[model samples]
Target: MTKNERLFISPLPRYAYWLFLLGILISILLGLLFYRQVSAMVQHQAEAELKRLSASTSDQFQVYLQQTEYGMNQAATEQYIQTAIEKRDAEVLNQLLYGWQQNRNHAELWAILDKDARIISTLRGSSDNHNPLSLNGLALRAMASANPIVSTEIINKEELARVGRNVSDRLENHHLLKQEGVLTQLVIVPVLGKNGQVLGALCGGLVLNDNQELLRSLFGNSQAMHAVYQDKQCIAYFTNDNKVSFPEQISPAMTKSCILDGQACLGQMQSDGDTYVTVSRYIFNAQNQVIGYQVLALPQSQYSQLPAWVANISLLTGFLLAIFSIIVIGNTSRIRQLFDRERQRGQESYYLGMFAQKLQECTDENEVYLLLKKYLSRDLDVIQMEFNIISADDNCMESIRFTENDQVSRVYLNQSKCKPVLTGRINIYNDDRDLHCNQIDTDLIKSHVCIPFLAGGKVAGVVGLGSPQEQYWTPGRIEYLDAYLNLIGPTVTNIRLLKLLQAKAFEDQLTGLKNRHFLDQYLLEQLAIAERYKTTLSLLMADIDRFKLVNDNFGHDAGDLVLKEVAAVIRAAVRESDLVARYGGEEFVLVLPNTSTDEAVSLAERCRQAVNSLQVIHNDYSRIISVTISIGVASYPRDGNSLEALYKLADSALYLAKNQGRNQVRTAQEYLATLQRTGCDD
Candidate 1:
């Protein structure tokens, strides 16, 4: 053959046959190994999922029982129930019961039993169970303990009829509602009179026959079914089909945990030829007491499939392996497509994870805003973006935009200006119906999309993105953008909430002045500055004259208005450098840095005159009330070294100003002069 010529060689048929057989053997061996590995992994994951389900089930029990008990206890304390019970008036009590019965979410029976265990219900309906409610049951326990009690009992047909409660009258749609016997929950909360005597018991009956609604809601799932047991007896059974009975029962160990111990249990069982990993726990009552047993049975789908496949591997070893090879070869391109798609999703998830980490480290919304600009801007080619966030105080909308210099520029706007915020949904602008958010400036960008994020069930902010391209927001980009918002939205909300809380903590609610706590921290800082720099810091202490009389005559509401008005006037007289605080009731304090006692006294005089000139309207009395204030001035490094000493001197001066005459100013020096004039004084 020439150097570039191709050579065609054919092998013998037996040689090809042996090689193919060897390939089949290798494929079969690999398949078994892979099956075992995957089965183990899936089994581990299933166990973990089972444990999680058990925890969720336990939480449901706690919440349900606690809510039921609390509701009954609150009902017992209702004024109507107490009054009717105290008066032995069945008509009024029945009226209340009738109203409660209308809400079918509540227990099957809502009635009141007298102290003698005699049914005092005015309800005309008969109980589904014929067996009478035991006198020594939940009601007796509630009355004897003088507290709410939750207990389970089996009632025969129409048992609650003795109390005038008709069981069949409620939600008769369920064929399973009527049974040979009914499992019922009796919640009893004792009603007490003014003297703390047990007047009656509020009895609630809950039917538990084939009731999957409770567990279904708790699990947020309807695909999987389970059972409830009271030892050997099944109280509730749920399955995919009503014709198929529950395939398992409570194990001996579960019985100990459920019945004897009234605690949770876990084990494995076989049901209808399928293996299940079961989680069992105690069902509780309103008193937070365990009364029954609940179970969660999840099929071991992974384990079940593994054994069957292991058997199939032997049945179709060589022939199936050859077909598998052919199938794998045929699906090579499709598998690659699947892998590429998964790789893209994985990349997106990695970026989102990093974004979430960065968002969590953010201390303020500005940092979060910066992160959005950094991460999302690159992915979406977003030329401009703005966050239309609602202020925590007034639902005020403020737009934050990034400029070319990377500086955050904020513009305040009305909350109603944004469509996404007002409508609580994402507003997409692609010339669709010629609709757009009024807040967006169309001149700045070619296309825009506004996405709203919710926190605490209300829209907290709208993230507006703009680009120089129309129809630019494709489905993929939109979905990715949603994920980005989900990560960053919570960070913005948390920062805003924290800021609101901090403002509320330091600022007074009524007067909008710095509270005592803030003043205390601020005073220490100012004092340190004065001492370190060897500068004078003057403190002005002022009091609203006859403030008590204002409250006593016009009521506290009017007094609040006077205080707010006075605070505003005082705040107007002081410079921004000066710190103003409400120092206890009707007393105001100002800390002025790098100032003389003379300047502080002058400012105090202005504050006093402003207050004297102001008139507050008490609308309730149709009165215009005139107010006056007394002021005293003290300076650091001149009057005293410490805050306490300066405050005492200022307080003494303020007392002197008030005694001398109302609506006047005094200094610590004046106080000393008066002490000398009086003589025999400290």
Candidate 2:
């Protein structure tokens, strides 16, 4: 046989198969052994690197959390917050936060909340771009925690909302974790009062996205170590790396991770069987309170730079060489195609993740909704995209649609000649001449894709995506939108609930003097401090002497008028800090935290005189009526230590003043005889 034929043909028939199998077996064995060794080495090195990096990152995060806690605590305790709280001036708080947010290089946003957690002021990077960071779940959590609660996880926009807190709990909802190339960290600190109540929360963040310098600092910077601050405000350090110290800017994730994990994860590394490893720890305050967190990550490629598959192939070659011959298969082009699609999918996933992240960072639901519409319009190149907020009544959808020029239009189905895309239920279609279409009076959305916005398992609103011209819609685009709706729908519902709750809390259902509930809690706190400091604290109890007579004479309508009249008179009598709470029935309680008893009594008398001299015409019969109030004064420490006690003392005085003369001021001591005769606490 010629050389070519001989090479192509088998050299030895039976023996050749045996030898080949033996060789393959030998290669497989070698490969297995090599893979094990490589894996072990990579794991050890990766773990070491991750440990070092985690230590550095964690330390830095702790430092940043500490600084933020300090700053927020300092700010919350400042006269500014106090002044704003006293004055109920949200603008003052906003100005303060806006000033802080303007400071470049600081990853901090400041906000002040009244007791009700309303966004009084928010300071972000720019004034025009600033969004109100609504406090809903966060405020509830903050109020529940006694220490500076750290959130288990933080949404980006939420971080922008809550700028300062010492301890945190993860919000029940969390943003999807990004495990692609970009890394994120979120940290939250609660601004606490002296009584260990959460006045507000502070949030900070750090991103490890294309920031190579920060990554280099973790691996390359020698002075990097992990440190944490406890509730007692003491700093503690923990690290395996001897050479590394902390950085000024800490990632939020590290802080969040440490607080969540509970125990100190000194050198823990989790591998994804690929190139990266994550290490994390739980931080505790001096009071054994877990206030901070730290985490670090490292790339396996950092050590030796060997492909993981190399080790598997090497091990297989040594231990299971026979497997190599069997491994060679006939599928090539099909596998390559699958791999290409996967690669494209990865890229799409990355962009989608980034879009979602940015979406989560949006403080305005409308902005996010518009952004989604824009993405569907511009990114997907859809002809048009529309969103609607479903109204309570089934009349029409509140159209929240966006255009190419970023113009938003609301198409009311009832008012305009638009086709009813929805009557009472959710509807989606690609119709051109729908009545809702005419609702879009602008020429932009003549026709396009339309979807209904559902919330709380009901059709809350309708979303109409329109195109001036006819366009093709794809299943993938629809799928993307479905996902977007899934995220935004719940957020919108939550915001709506939040707004409703906020209105109920801040608004008065009746007389509107803040509220008795808010006043009793807030003023009692102020009074407590005044009492502690030996400062003057006063309370005035007033009762409209003849209020009941109005109810008897003019039916309940006239009685309601008198109550409103009394409320107006009371409001006109005192300054803002001096709260007037409707104690009960026709009586009102005035709390003056920094006023002397004499001043309080004088103020009460003014309200009394105002009510007495005021005339109300019952009818056209030309009959005029006037009412007077008996005033009671009680001073803190001199009267009683507690709110209830002061109220009782003042009420007793009021009763005595009423009995002695209908419209005169009386002190608690002056009413002591009456209290003894009545044998009642009042």
Instruction: Give a tens-digit lDDT track for model 2, residues 162-212.
Output: 443221222222222222111234344455555655555444344322233
RMSD from true fold, candidate 1: 13.8
- Candidate 1 residue-wise lDDT, 488-534, digit = tens: 65455555544554566578888999998888789889999989998
Return the TM-score for candidate 1, rounded to 2 decimals. 0.54
* Predicted structure with the largest lDDT when compared to the true one: 1
Error of 1 at 598 (Å): 1.7
Count of clashes, each model: 15, 74
Q: Give the top-scoring candidate (TM-score).
A: 1
Model 2: residues with Cα > 4 Å off, grouped in runs: 1-331, 392-396, 402-407, 415-436, 440-447, 467-471, 511-545, 548-682
Return the number of clashes found in candidate 2: 74
